[model samples]
Target chain A: MKNIPGDLKFLSSHEWARVESDGTITIGISDHAQDLLGDIVFVELPEVGQTLDAETDAAIVESVKAASDVYSPLSGEVMEVNSLLEDQPEIINTSPYEDGWFYKLTPSDLSELDNLLSPEDYSDVCED
Target chain B: MNKTPLYDAHIKLGAKMVNFSNWEMPISYSSLIEEHNAVRNAVGVFDVSHMSIFDFDGGDQVAFFEKIFANDVKKISKGNKAIYGALLNEKGGILDDLIIYNANDKFRLVSNCSTRNQNRQWFEKHAVEFGVKVIERSDMGILAIQGPEAMSKILAIKEIHAEANNLQSFGCMFDDDRLYAKTGYTGEDGLELIVPNMAINDLWDQALEVGCVPIGLGARDTLRLEAGLNLYGNDMTINNHPYESNLGWTIDMSDESRQFIGKDALLSIDQSKSQKIVGVILRDRGILRSGYEITHEQGKGEVLSGSFSPTLQSSIGLARVDQGYQENGKVFIRNKALNIEFVSPRFIRKVKMQP
Candidate 1:
């Protein structure tokens, strides 16, 4: 069974989101997503300052098996991007929730986090 | 989708299955890299029963093969020796690559399962003229036991033929009603066994009981790729000729009087225009993939097959570059062009010779 972090909210597509006190949301692929895509070789992060709508293609993660698009769970302007992934994509495979965060976004609306899946909901989604 | 004889076995082992050529096949038993290393460092078994095996029997068998195969059968007159070559169209395009085993009284030709039906039809179309009998052996199961310690492990297995220890590379022998050939796709010292369907389950159990891990097709590909082996549909197709696909060595141009299919077109084509297969290693970080562009100081080319080589722990690939290609090549991955080093297509060698 994959771990569904109780602290973070999730999208059905497997991206996890955590809203900071500053109202900025940090996003990354769920642990299940990283496990499915073993040995990630490249992570193409969204450029800082780019604006993205909810559920848009926000990043690209390529594993040895195949390439997958990381979707944004909420609409926001990219505040910070994970530049470390350019050389160390395997970090995502090893620590997908912590250092593997794709990008930080200052959400256009803070209320959008409530619309996303809760930990219990995301766990149920993964089960299916 | 079709299923192999070992489909249930793969599922029982928690293998991730995929649709390979309309057949339900296991792509990985564990992590792809772990399975890959198991074959490189130790022993592993692959269920390749999906491959098409055709048995030819008749006095005209040799004559039919000489006409059909690009390689000369005269080179393999003995029962054990096997000849690897291409079955070509009249225009010199590769219909399929196959290994023909000289079984003394008759011959057995093994080709890819992806082209099984087409190969059967082609053989039937030509067999009428030579009065050759072609029998497709779907009832046979093939297991490739490969790696550095593969031969020793097989020899230790009580159920396997003891005669397997004596078979040289490309040499085949029949013992206890099973054919064991000291041949493998991976650049390793091993044997590919063709066992009767009834004995397959027991043979698999015994191999595992003796410590042979079951490897899947995903590792089988990376292992072969790291060893500088070419994949059929990915590296070459009917559109590409043998000379451009690094299979020119398999063709026999000697014995000028002997005729093979596609010989005339091969002779008529300009050899100078052919692209040579070269190995590419990415200098920078990025995953190289098929259809990626390759630019060099002399010319341009395309990556036929590329992946993260677990043995080498880096990105590597086989690309077909235009003639006169030497050094200073770059592969375009995503939007960035990364510098690459070109090396001989063969990455690893078990010995000076295959045997």
Candidate 2:
């Protein structure tokens, strides 16, 4: 597989983030997290305008096998969630980086991205 | 841990491994949910060769099994079969649940993998008195092709459906040395093909190429649970009697003439005070798992087998509940309690072949 655009920031919690042109940021679970969760059947997204920290529970993803908590990628206010997940939860398991993007947020501070794992660093963690 | 013949194929397909009955077997390939759904909506093949297949040889084999098992073993003909039968002690305590294939005078038995050794010993102890032969066919391999498209897949490869219309549910076909039982743990239509050890690869290749995704024990548990089928160790055990485990129908207490192994003692069994098994569905958001405590308004219950039902879209379980506890009562899943309905084991989708 080609590189998953290393420019996107990563959280230790296995979430990936990319800043949007509107100054807001798009967020979703990393490919690794989705792979671990298996088939995602239900997703509970964060409400718009809900303030969340960089590393605290902000959403829920329940699969046919088990349920998991989706963490916020950056400390910011939630702007929008991918409502399509209500019917197409498996989309995350199939395409976590693209159609599976969960929500968007405006970063409290772009410097916090330093705490996130780079694509290389994230791959190493998953390898182990 | 021992690996089944399909271990390499499962591993190569990136199956998740788990320890089951001392064997390291694949629990699922890409996703447990997807593989699970495939079995429910379409069809899936399972590598169940780790389970023990015992062939009873020589004379009086039919008489021996009929005496030991609670099911009417005498009813099965050469090509027909019997359902899960109980080996009960004198007091009705279940020894083990197994299926007997009446391969003419010789019978081929498929038993629970975890109870393989114990079942073998029990069969041996009883065979001497009945004058029968018992040999463990450990060299045999079993592949269960189950679900709606099960018959189609097998017919596509082999002309095995000739016995479908005749081999009733829980029936078997003893073609040469192989045993094809119309039985499955999943509440789906399928055949459990027991082939010689050497034919495992060839049979597996044919089953897989015909669009049967290889399923694992994990899916097996989920599928059976959705169907409300009981697991041997979970739903019933030595400490519990067949009557108390809701297997009362299997006990042949009415056959006064047939002096079977456990008949005399079963007559004295006190069914009025037994804690019978019942099915439960969790009404809460929490996923119910095994070993969780259960308590109703009347008394306490224990979850025998529990999981998130992929088909039902809810958490379900089989529990040993107090007989007095109204079948419909509140179920305690972990610490949270939820009101669930009391129902029979007929929760699985109905298959055409099922009578």
Candidate 3:
């Protein structure tokens, strides 16, 4: 079983969303997602200031096995993208939650978090 | 999915299993990069038992192979040697690429698992006229011990150490039910062992005890790509011929009197008009994947096998492009056409490393 931090909200596609104290929502793939992708070689991050729709492709993660699209959990304007992942994409494999966050965005509607799956619900999804 | 004899062993080693050509095989144990480097710098063992192996025997065995195989098997029939060649259809299309080993009284042909059924049918269809018996050796398991230190590590095995010690490249030695061949898909000095399924687990354990790192299909792929070896279905298929698949060398047309399966159709093909497989290095970021389009000065083609090469630390691929395409081309990944430098299909050769 993979770790599903209780503090975060998740999409069925495996993206996790955590609302920061500053009101910006941080996004990254879940531990289960990285484990399934295996040995990430490249990461394509969304551009800062770009508007993204909920449940849309916001980034791409390429592993030796295959390439996968990382979707946005909620509609938002990209605030800051992780520039460090440009050189060290494997960080997502090692630390998917903290250091490997893909990007942060200012949500068009903060209430959208309620529509996302909770930690418990996401864990069940992973199990299936 | 079908499971190999080493399924339990792979599970015990915490391997990440995946479905490959209908077989449940390990994709990686720890990491693809780490396993790839292990085979490049040290020694690594791969459970390649998923590949199909067939044995040929009878009075007309040699004649049967000469009629169906593209390469001249007569060259290796004299000694304990192995020759790489392609099985072709009457239309000059490649059926499969395999290695044929001269195992004393009998010949052993190892081929890809994906084309097992079709290859068997093709072999059987042709064997009848030559009065040869084509037997599938499904009870045997194959292990590829590769890397710079592969030879020394395999020599640690006590059973056939002396016999395999002085084996030359493309050479093979058989001991009862076991066969050891100094050939591998990875462009590294290694030994490929064919052993009975009952004793495969013990051999795998011995390989690990001898300091050989356990590798999975993931690294096996990257290693072979780095070595410029072609994957059967990816690089060549029923729609392709040896002339276009960078395997023209495997075909021998010297003996005009010898007419193989595809000899007539291959002879009629305009060599200068055929698209050829070439190596492409991405000048931009991101990985290259199969089916990506390539636009050259002459025409467009597609990537056959593409991936990020761990050895080169850059993205590289084998692409079939127009016959007139030159040194540089552009590959369309997504909506953008990125610059790519074309070179010989082979990306790397065996690098002598310190033991």
Candidate 1 TM-score to native: 0.94
Displacement of the residue B165 alpha carbon in candidate 1, Å: 0.8
lDDT per residue (tens digit) for residues B178-213 in model 2: 788778888888888898878888788888889998
The lowest-lDDT stretch of 10 consecutive residues in candidate 2 chain B is B346-355
lDDT per residue for candidate 3 within B273-355, as digits (tens), equals 98899999999998999999999998989998999899899999999888888888999988888999998767886832111
Candidate closer to the true structure by TM-score (higher is better), 2 or 3? 3
- Fnat of candidate 3: 0.88
Per-prediction DockQ, in order? Answer: 0.58, 0.30, 0.89
lDDT of each: 0.85, 0.77, 0.90
* Top model number, TM-score: 3
| Clashing residue pairs for model 3 | none
Off by over 4 Å in 2: A1-30, A42-62, A66-92, A95-122, B12-14, B77-79, B89-91, B159-166, B257-269, B324-328, B332-334, B349-355
lDDT of 3 by residue, A1-128 (tens): 55677889999999999989999999999999999998899998999999999999999999987899999998999999999999999999999999999999999987888899999999899999
Task: Report how far off residue B99 is in candidate 3 (Å).
Answer: 0.7
TM-score of chain B of 2: 0.93
